[model samples]
Target chain A: MVKAKIYVQLKASVLDPQGKAVTTSLHAIGYERVADTRISKYIEIIFDETDLAAVDTQVHSICDKLLANPNTEHYHFELETME
Target chain B: MRVSVITFPGSNCDQDALEVFETRGHTVHSIWHKDTDLQNPDLVILPGGFSYGDYLRCGALARFSPIVKEVVAHAQRGGYLWGICNGFQILTETGLLPGTLLMNNTLQFICQHQYIRIETANTPYTHGLRVGTALDIPIAHKEGNYFIDEPGLRELQDQDRIVFRYCDADGNIAPGTNPNGALDDIAGICNTTRNILGMMPHPERAATDSVSSNDGKQIFRALEDYFTTRA
Candidate 1:
């Protein structure tokens, strides 16, 4: 079995309003020297497939087609084996 | 004209869309998201509301619903399709329309009447309205900020697909008048063929003067006139 963890975030050029709001609150609470802060989504998926190569391809396709919007967001994933 | 409104799991504006179509003297059909078969209609609309609770980003899950395939087919066959608010999000997710709606720059769910300047009256929804006419319409959403890459924006402009832009009362396009930080104050856009239109404003909410400005009703009137001319 393979488990996958995906991290999705808005592209560098896109403005992240939610992330900016969080940063503003952090500043209000006295966090200094913080130049920037961005937010991302963490998703986990477990696959029953034993073929590592095939599982990797499947996970990438899922991220490209569903987990992220290619227009404004970028995504990367890590896979590992579970006992 | 016959109108079909698709009701997703959380569509709150389906009834309003139906009523408006009926009031315009058109037959209306309500279709569910899970249903595969679609009734033939002069226009198909995807109404507003938090479809699938707007999980995993707005309009992400709802775009995969079975009925969307039929809607795509209908649009491809030269039928008219309009998506309002959440429906507009679904169109971008389904690739029926270009660009995407992002979180509002203020990070708040804004609900108010806004002024939108008509950019082009070439589509069935805007054929009767003159360019530069400002209409008072209601917009209610947290993710109505439109975004498209620079090249994409230029392409849309070149094709004249941008149908409406958020503007002030006098139709001046300026940063101060932009409710949401959209790339170009874009409020509504259509496909290159002008058949599919996706907009952030709630035209149905402003269809009656009893509650709010009826300037939005001009959209329906334009459609009726468009169909009459074609017939």
Candidate 2:
């Protein structure tokens, strides 16, 4: 089995209000050293196939089609083999 | 005019949209998201609410609904399509409309009456309205901030596709008047074809006097006029 781990985040150009709010909270709690915070989503999918090449293609396709929105987000994925 | 309102699971405003049209004496149909048929209506509306409980992002999951295929085809055929609030998010998800609705800058769900200025009267959706006409529409959403890339923003401006902008009662566009931190204070926009509109306001909620603001009726009237005059 192959497992795909994906990270999806708003494009750098887009504003992330939730991330900003977290940063504000951190600062309020005296974490002034933190420069910024950008929130992102992490997703994991397991495929029945063991082929890394095939899983890579499928993972990319899934991210483009549904897992992430290309308009405002950018996504990256890593593949790991599972016994 | 024949109108269809799509009802996705958790859609709360489907009936409101249908009631508004039915009261206007137009034929109205409620199309389920699972159905592939659109019933040959002249207009299709994706109503407001937390579809799929807004899971995986608002409107993201709902865009994959079977009926959206027909909705896309309908828009391609130049039929009128309007996405209100969550509906607007779905339109963006489906790529029928550009840009995305992000969470409000305040990080809170905002529900209140907002004044929006009509930016263009050239589209089928705003045919009879004059530019800069302010309508008292109600907006209710957690994610209503509209964002687009610089090039996309320029294209929308150059093509005159920005249909509505959140503004003051006096029709001034400013940050103070913007309920959400949308780029350019945009509240609504249309496609390059000018047939599809995605707006983050509930016109149906303000369509009757009982709602204390019938300003939204002007939009419905403009739609009816578009058909009646063309027919």
Candidate 3:
């Protein structure tokens, strides 16, 4: 079995209103020296595949189709085999 | 039937939308930002504009407006809605729609003509158009790029919710043909139910008789026809 971790976030140039709002609130609450902020989601899963290429393909298919919206968000995945 | 167009203090396209519906013989009402109780419009339109001065983020401030809350509720009940440009931003901000709008990869505002493919023309918002057809519409925005994660992107495609896409003048979805560089050259998409449409391109902007404006007339005509037929 192989485990995967996916980190997703809005592209660098994309506007993050929710993240900005939180930053504003933090600043108001006296969190100084904070220069930037962003928000993203993480997902983890286990796939029972021995072929590395097949596992990669399946993981990419899931992300490109559902886990992320490539138009606004970008995602990278990390995988490791179960011991 | 009555159509409601919500107007924020900073909204730029409210009048254009209002005129289009009025010409179609539908009663049009302009709702203010502070009114939480919507007059319950049969059709609601969130026009394109830099609402709330694009503060914090595009459509971010407007998403919290009293009018938006009611609009969100109306959509949940299977109400018909059309969001263009800034309205699209508001929809994402309010969580009424999936996927978020990000800044242009160029980090600059873009205003120009674009070719969008009709990915799914079966919805109330796109019924008049046929699948895989090409449309030439104008899109203007600083943040118009769409993004989603792996699982989420798949779910969107699997559900057949994609409605519009940027393509060549011939309606081809290719890499170099996109004006906004959207994923799959996506110009617009709908909720899983295919009732709520959020698109960055301004169909209303293309409805005018002035050069290059009437391209969006088909979209409005489709809606007008649907309402009349149901009535």
Candidate 4:
């Protein structure tokens, strides 16, 4: 079995309003050193198969095709083998 | 004219769309998202409201609904397709329209009457509108901020595919008039073929005289005008 951890975030060029709001609140609470803040989605998927190469390809496809918008978001994934 | 409004699980505006179309003296059908076949209506509308409960982004999950395949095929055959609000998000998610709707610049759920200047009257939805006319419509969404790559936006402008721009009451498109900070103040756009249109405003909400503004009635009338020409 394999488990995949995916992170999806809007590209840097895209403005993140939620992140900016969080940053503003942080500053109000006295986190003055915080220059900026960004938010993203973290998704986890588990597969029953043990084929590492095939799992890698499938995970990438899932991220590219569904989890991320190529126009505004980027994604990365890490996989771990299950004992 | 015949219109079909697709209703996804969470779609709240399908009935509104149907009412407006029917009131305009057209046969309207309510199609479920899971249906793979359409009844060959003259126009298909993906109405507003959070589809799939806004899961995985506004329209991401709804884009893969079974009926979208048929909708795409219908568009490929030059059928008129209109998407409003969340429906517009679905269009972008499905790649039927370019750009993406991100969280509002204020990071808030905004629901209010807004103005949009008609950029072009070339599409069926805007056929009866004069260029530069400002229409008051209701807009309600948290992710209505539109974003597109620079080159793609330039190309869309070059092709005159941009249909509407958020504007002031006098039809000015300055930054203050942009409610959601959408790139280029874009509120509505059409595909290259001009048959598919997606917009964030709710024309159906403003189509009735009982409503404060009936400015949106023209959009439905424009469709009828477009159909008359074809007939």
Candidate 5:
């Protein structure tokens, strides 16, 4: 089995309101060194296929089609093969 | 005119849109999201709702609905398509419209009467309205902040695709008046062909005087006038 871990996040130029609120709370709790915070989504998918190259292509297509909005978000993935 | 309002699994405003069009003496139909046919609608509306329980993203999953193919085809043929609130998000998701709707800056679901100024009166949606005319409409959504890249924003501006902008009662556009912190205070926009419109405000909810203001009626009236003139 092959497992893929994907991380989706808003682009640097796009504003992240939830992340900003978290940063504010962190400061209030005495974490003054925290200058920025951004929230992102982590997704994991398992595939039965063993071909790494083919899986890579499918993962990229899935990310572009459903996992992320290209207009505001970007994503990257890492694949691990498990026997 | 024949109008069709699409009802997704969680859509709550489908009836409201139908009622508004019916009251205006137009034939209205409720189309299910799974249905592949638009039934030859003169105007198609994607109403506001939390389709697919808003899983993953606001309109991401809903875009994959079976009916979306027909909706896209309708727009490609220059048919009138209007999306309201959640519908606006779906339009952006389907790539039928530019830009995306992000979570509100306040991180809260804002529901209230919002004043939006007509940015351009050239489109069929705002045909009879004058620029800077303020219409009191209600907006209810958590992810209504519109975002577009720099070049896309420039294209929209240069092509006059921006249809409405959030503004004060006096028609002044400012940060304080922007309910969702949409870039440039944008409340609504249309496609380059000017046949498709996506807006966060719910004009149907304010279409009657008893609801608050009947300013929303002007939009329907303008659309009716456009069709009449064309006929």
Candidate 6:
């Protein structure tokens, strides 16, 4: 089995509305120094595979083809063999 | 054509998306998020709303929904998908779409008639739109601002993968015109193939002239037009 963890985020050029809102609320509550607030997701996948490299490619392809939109998203994966 | 609008428990736009599809002469199905069977539709849409009450962040919890499992499978087979607002967030959560929708730079619950520029109109969803044209769509969200890393955004821009940018009515680059303060006024985007389009604006809300600026109709028209041409 191979386990892969994925991190996904919006591109920098796009505005992060939710993060900004949270920051605003913080400011309203007197936490005025909060410079930034951005949101993101962490995805973990475990699948059985014989070839680690092949599964690694599969993980990336999954992220590329479906998991993440390369245009507006950035995805990084950490893959390791499961004991 | 058949279109399925996914209904998450907190989803607010399922009906809106369905209504637009119906208006366009396509059969629209309201598929709940709990159902595993996709029923094999021509297209699937994740409508906007606060799914799972936006627990663990917007669209994050819904990414593990029963339906998303099947949605991922269908996408693997080259299925077409679309996401708007929270729907776009869910797609990001499920790793089906690209980019993360972060907090707005200014942090406000903005509800405004925003603008979007068509950077690339080649995809099935954007095919009918002319290059460099603009769409005046309404964007109502608390977390519609979009963000990505430097290298990643540059790659998309370099490949013309950057499809839609937020713009003024005249479609010029100006601050404050961007409702969410997105970098480059990016309001929407698509995958490399353009099969999947995720945007912040509510095209369904503006599909009718009576209620809106009528710019929303063009997005639906573009998708339907492309579907017709290919099918």
lDDT of 3 by residue, B1-99 (tens): 688999997999999999988987888998888987667788899989999898656786787687887897898898888888999888877777887
Model 1 Cα lDDT, one tens digit per residue, B143-194? 9999999999999999999999999999999768888888889999999889
| Number of the top-ranking candidate, with DockQ as the measure | 5
**Model 1: colliding residue pairs:** none
Computed on C-alphas against the true complex, the DockQ of each candidate is 0.90, 0.85, 0.08, 0.92, 0.96, 0.25
Order the numbered candidates by DockQ, best leading.
5, 4, 1, 2, 6, 3
Global lDDT of each candidate: 0.92, 0.93, 0.80, 0.93, 0.94, 0.79
**Model 1 clash number:** 0
Q: How would the docking of model 4 be graded? A: high
Model 4: residue A36 alpha-carbon error in angstroms: 1.4
Off by over 4 Å in 2: none
How many pairs of residues collide in model 4?
0
DockQ of 3: 0.08
Better of 3 and 6 by DockQ: 6
Top lDDT hit: 5
* Model 2 agreement with the true structure over A1-83: per-residue lDDT tens digits: 98899999999988888899999999999999988999999999999998899999988899889988888999998999998
Q: Could you give candidate 5's per-residue lDDT for residues B1-231 as a string of tens digits?
A: 999999998998999999999988999999999999898999999999898898999889989999999999999999999999999999999999999999999999999989999999898889988999999999999999999999999999999999999999999986689999899899999999999999999999989656877888989999989989987
- iRMSD, model 2, in Å: 0.7
TM-score of each: 0.98, 0.98, 0.73, 0.98, 0.98, 0.75
Tell me how much of the true interface, by contacts, candidate 2 captures: 0.80
lDDT of 4 by residue, A5-67 (tens): 999998999998889999999999999999999999999999998999999999989988899
| Candidate 4 backbone collisions, by pair | none
